[model samples]
Target: MKHNFGAGPCILPKEVFQEASQAVLDFNNTGLSILEISHRSKEFEEVVVETERLVRELLNVPQNYSVLFLQGGASQQFAMVPLNLLPEGGKAAYFDTGVWATKAAKEAKKIGQVEIVASSSDKNYNYIPKGFEIPADSAYFHYTSNNTIYGTEVFEKPTTSVPTVVDMSSDILSRVIDITDYDLIYAGAQKNMGPAGVTLVIIKDEILGRSGRSLPSILDYEPHIKAGSMYNTPPVYSIYVSMLNLRWLKAKGGISVIEQENIVKARTLYDEIERNPFFKGTAAVEDRSRMNVTFVMENSDLEAEFLALSKERNLIGIKGHRSVGGFRASIYNALSITSINALVDAMREFEEKHK
Candidate 1:
């Protein structure tokens, strides 16, 4: 068995992949591949509708909000949020925690003024910035809930009177969050959902039209909402797979149960990092992410050897991001605790052999 810990386009449930595979060859017994089906067909329409419904149900999204299954990844949302929410000459506040957060702030700057209320860049993003105040006058306060590159997370929503926007690309559905707290939430479906190509956006209806600029039809939220996420040819395969995954999530006792499993998985790995003398966690203890656990060997010389050991044990994608050279174990919802234990066992074996 292979243990997958890669960050994006990460592991999904076996059953979901199996179901999706069959759909690719023959979707819903229609004899047409999901890849070749028309987006306007009733069959595909049901897929889109059911996907949206699952999102609303799982997230407990408020009645006032609208869910959209968009094409572009969360990167597009960096611009879309500012385009639709940030008015001309308006200012927005950002919490710069890592690479993705900084990129989001940079994109918003092109459209309007962006104030970085707080950031952890000074320490290579090993922790989430704390005690920062969101400017009341800003259009919206944007933040990334979980920083995949840095292995840091903001567990609690910031308390701000202004509208709140979050890039939850990595952490969505891993835990339960009050969806009504944010004016807008966007996530790339690659990590915890299903696969790449589909982006999920949930917006409070009242938040739209605040930006007075005339956006292109594709960029505008109103058009997508009106068209029911079929504004153009949607990512049919990705959406269908996501729907299957969401259904699996619902069947497994929803977010509450899964959140507990995630907690246990994180604790299991973090405990090993803390107890083992050869390894040390990189992120601040208080802000460590439940989804991605990052650590480094105490002796720099042992890093390469430990990585080789991990590979020898069928532990793949344990290597960290290129920007930050260390091991990152991304234990998303579908990543079984047994895989985490296998990683832990590998680490112990390496330590005993070396010591």
Candidate 2:
């Protein structure tokens, strides 16, 4: 079996895939494919409810918070957040760490003023900036918790009193986080939660309608919350599969258990990268992500050959993003430690050949 390490549309538990695939033919004995069923039907509604409950329970989300499964991914959220939070002419503070963070600030600028507190772009986003200042008068502060392309992550929520929003698209649910730490959190479901079509949003209820700008019903979070994520036809299949994956995660002892595994997986791979003479990591040691591990070779010319060998060994998606131009191994919740080992072994093989 090939090890999958692609950035998004992530790997899911085998059991989740089996159950999701079965639902495509027949969902929970409804005699109807999940795709064919009316989203308003009780069966699908139960799926949404359970999915939300699982999310709340796993994250220990506060009762005052609203959990929603919506469409258009975190990219959509980039606009929705500023539209719903930043009032007319108000400024928002944003911390820029990578591409998504920059894009988020850019979108917010189109809606209102944005103050970039700090940026790591000077070093091609290889590290997280420190000692940044968020304006106390700003409407809210926003940041991307994880940078997938650069393989850097912000583990601790930056110290700020203002309302905080985080785009945790790539690293949500992989580790344990206190739900009350932020005013709003949005993650694209494709990375660790489920699939591409749905985006999971957890928002503090009081933050709604703060913008005072009349928004399109679909673009507004209030309407979606009022409709119970059924404002329009939701991403039925994506939500259902996410529910299944959540169930699998729960059965595997939830986020805490998976987090330990993730730590070990990341350490194993990083250990190989450090031990191998030919390899070197790109991200700062302190900010290196536990989800996506980015590394490069001492001799950049050997990248193509190493990628070819990785494929021969049944490894997939180890190639890094064009911007980074190195190998990025994305180790999501469902990716087994075994897969990490396979990649490490391949690195050793390359070292043997070169040494």
Candidate 3:
């Protein structure tokens, strides 16, 4: 069996893949493939509705929020959030933890004035900044909940009086979050939720028309909300697969159960990284992420050899990103504790070989 740890467009449950594969040929016994069905069809419409319902149920989202399945990934949300929430000439506050957070702030800058409340650039984003003051008068405060590249996460929402928005692409469903605390939360579905092509946005309804600037219908939240996420042809197959994945999540006892498993999986790996003399974790202990665990060998020369051994052991996509060139084991919802064990076993084997 192969263990997959790719960051995005990453692994989904085996059952989800099996079901999605069948749908590609025949969805729900319909003659047409899921890909071929009209977005307006009753069957496809049911899929979209169930997908939204599952999101709300799993997250305990309130009725006042709109759950949208959008086209562009979280990158588009970087623009849309500001376009909808940040009015012309208004200022927004952002916290920069990594590349995605930096990009979010950069996009907001194009729309209006943006203040970077704090940043971890001094430490290469290995940690989350603290004690930063968010301007109470800012239109909104934005931050990325999890930094995939740096393997850091802000588990606690910062105290801010202004409206709060989070880019949760990598960690949206990995744990429990209070929906009432934030005015908006957006995530690219590729990581914990499902496949690529669909981005999830949960926005408090009152914030929809606050920007005041006229937006293209497609870019505007009102049209999509009014149309029930069918402003145009949606990503049908992606939403279908996402629905299946969400079903899997619900069947597995929801977020609270999966969260405990994730905690155990992350700790099991991080514990080995600490106990093993040959390797060391990269992120600060307090800021380490439960979804992506990053670490490196003490002696860099043996890096390539261990990578080869990992491949030999059927470990795939464990290589780290270019920015932080070590190893990033993306332990998303679909990756099992068994896979984490496989990785820990590999680490132990590498240590024995080195010793």
Candidate 4:
């Protein structure tokens, strides 16, 4: 069995990849590859339409909300979000969690005043910052739902009187969430969706039109939403594969079922880490992520041997971010229970041998 633990452009359901590969070669038996199909064609339109429908159906998004599949990863949305929502000189509340959150805040700074309502940097981002007040006059309150590089997560989102915009790049569909809780949610498709190249944006109707700035055709959200994510030539293959993934998720009883599975998977690995003598977890227990399980050995001496053994066992991408040195096993949506179990087993086996 092969287990992939890479962070982005990570593992997808083998079935989804297989079906997508077929489409790339011969879409709908139309004798055309998805890559070459015109975005205006009915074939591609169906793909976009189905993707939108599946997104709303899977997440129970309200009618007033619009979903757009666009180019530029979540990073671009970071800038677009502040530009679209912030009034002239208006401010926004930002929570600094990790790399992505910092990027979002940095972009927001360019548009208007930014208040660091909360931050976890003091603790090296091993814990979530809590108990910050959102400025009532702020245009929107933005936070990163999960910190991918640091293995930290804000499980219970902070409440704000203003509109809430979330960068859900790493943990968008990993669980069930009420769409009404946020005005805008942006997720890069690479992590839990399909591939890199596209970003998913869900925006509420009310919060738009505040920017007032003249946005380039590509930077504006309304244009893409109006064109049904086909405003310009889209990444058809990525969106098509994401549709298949959403379909796979719907078949498995939607987000509720997967949320439970994610909990079990995370707990199984975290429990082993907590119990093992040579292992120590990095993220605070209360703020640990359900998708990325990060930990470190008692000493760094055995790192080479551990990685080599894991690779030998067909496990991949267990290395942590360079900024935070340790082991990070990314248990994304496509990662199976059996795979997590194998990682746990390997940990135990390694501990027994090393101890």
Task: State the C-alpha lDDT per candidate.
Answer: 0.93, 0.94, 0.94, 0.89
**TM-scores vs. true structure, each candidate:** 0.99, 0.99, 0.99, 0.98
For model 3, the local distance difference test gives 0.94
* Tens digit per residue, CA lDDT, model 1, 1-355: 8989888799999999899999989999999999999999999999999999999999999889999999789989999999999999899999999999999999999999999999899999999877889999999999999999889999988889999999999999999999878899999999988899999999999999999999999999999999999889998889999999999999999999999999999999999999999999999999999999999988978899989988999898999887777799999999999999999999999889988
Clash pairs for candidate 2: none
Tell me which residue pairs clash in candidate 3. Answer: none
Give the clash count for each candidate.
0, 0, 0, 0
Give, for candidate 4, the lowest lDDT window spanning 10 residues.
299-308
- Indicate the worst ten consecutive residues by lDDT in candidate 2: 128-137
Q: Which residue runs does candidate 2 get wrong by more than 4 Å? A: none
* lDDT (10s digit) by residue, model 3, range 1-355: 9999999899999999999999999999998889888899999999999999999999999999999999889899999999999988899999999999999999889899999999999988999988889999999999999999999999999999999999999999999989999999999999999999999999999977888998999999999999999999999999999999999999999999999999999999999999999899999999999988888889988999999999999999999988888899999999999999999999999889879
Model 3: how far residue 237 lies from native, Å: 0.4
Q: What is the alpha-carbon lDDT of model 2 when measured against the actual structure?
A: 0.94
Better of 3 and 4 by TM-score: 3
The digit string of per-residue lDDT tens for model 2 on 308-353 reads 9999999889999999997999999999999999999899888888
Residue 5's lDDT in candidate 2: 94
Worst 10 residues of 3 by lDDT: 206-215
Residue-level error in angstroms, candidate 2, position 181? 0.6
